[model samples]
Target: MSKVRITQVKSVIDRPERQKLTIKALGLGKINRSVEQENTDAIAGMIRKVSHLVTVEEI
Candidate 1:
C-alpha cells in the first residue's frame, strides 16, 4: 500500500476548534512535524479538512 507524509507547516493558533482537533487527529501538534500514514480515504478527508495548515507528499 502507498503512504503519505503529512507535515504541519503552519501553527493552529487563531484557527477554528474543529481545525485544531483535526490537526491533532493527524498526529501533529507542532510546526514542521511530519507523520507517515496510510493513503486512505479517511486520512485524505482529514488532511483536506486542514489543508491550509499542512502539506502532504505521497511516498
Candidate 2:
C-alpha cells in the first residue's frame, strides 16, 4: 500500500467527539504531531472525516 503522512495542524478543542477520536486513532493528539499511515480506503475515510483538523500528504 502507498504511504501518506497525516499532520494535526489544528487543535481538537471544541471539536466533535467523533473527530477527536479519529485524530487519536490516527496517532495524533497535539498540534504539529504527525503519523504515517497506509493509503487505504478506511484511512482515507478517517482523513476525510477530519480534513479540517489536519493536513495529508502522499509519501
Candidate 3:
C-alpha cells in the first residue's frame, strides 16, 4: 500500500479549533513534525481540511 507523508509546516495558532484537533489526531502538534500514514480516504479528508497548514507527499 502507498503511504502519505504529512508535515506540519505552519503553526496551529489562530486556526479553527477543529483544524487544530485534526492536526493532533494526525499525531502532529509541532511545526515541521512529519507523520507517515496510509493513503486512505479518511486521512485524505483530514489533510484536505488542513491543506493550508501541512505539506503532503506520496511515498
Give each prediction's root-mean-square deviation over alpha carbons. Answer: 0.6, 0.5, 0.6
lDDT of 1: 0.96
lDDT of 3 by residue, 1-59 (tens): 69999999999999999999999999999999999999989999999999999999999
Each prediction's whole-model lDDT (CA): 0.96, 0.96, 0.97
Q: Model 2, residue 43: displacement in angstroms?
A: 0.4
In candidate 1, what are the lDDT values of residues 1-59, reduced to their tens digit? 79999999999999999999999998999999999999889999999999999999999
Q: What TM-score should be assigned to candidate 3?
A: 0.96
Residue pairs in steric clash, candidate 2?
A: none
lDDT of 1 at 43: 93
- The most accurate candidate by lDDT is 3
Better of 1 and 2 by TM-score: 2
Candidate 1 residue 15 Cα shift, in angstroms, is 0.4
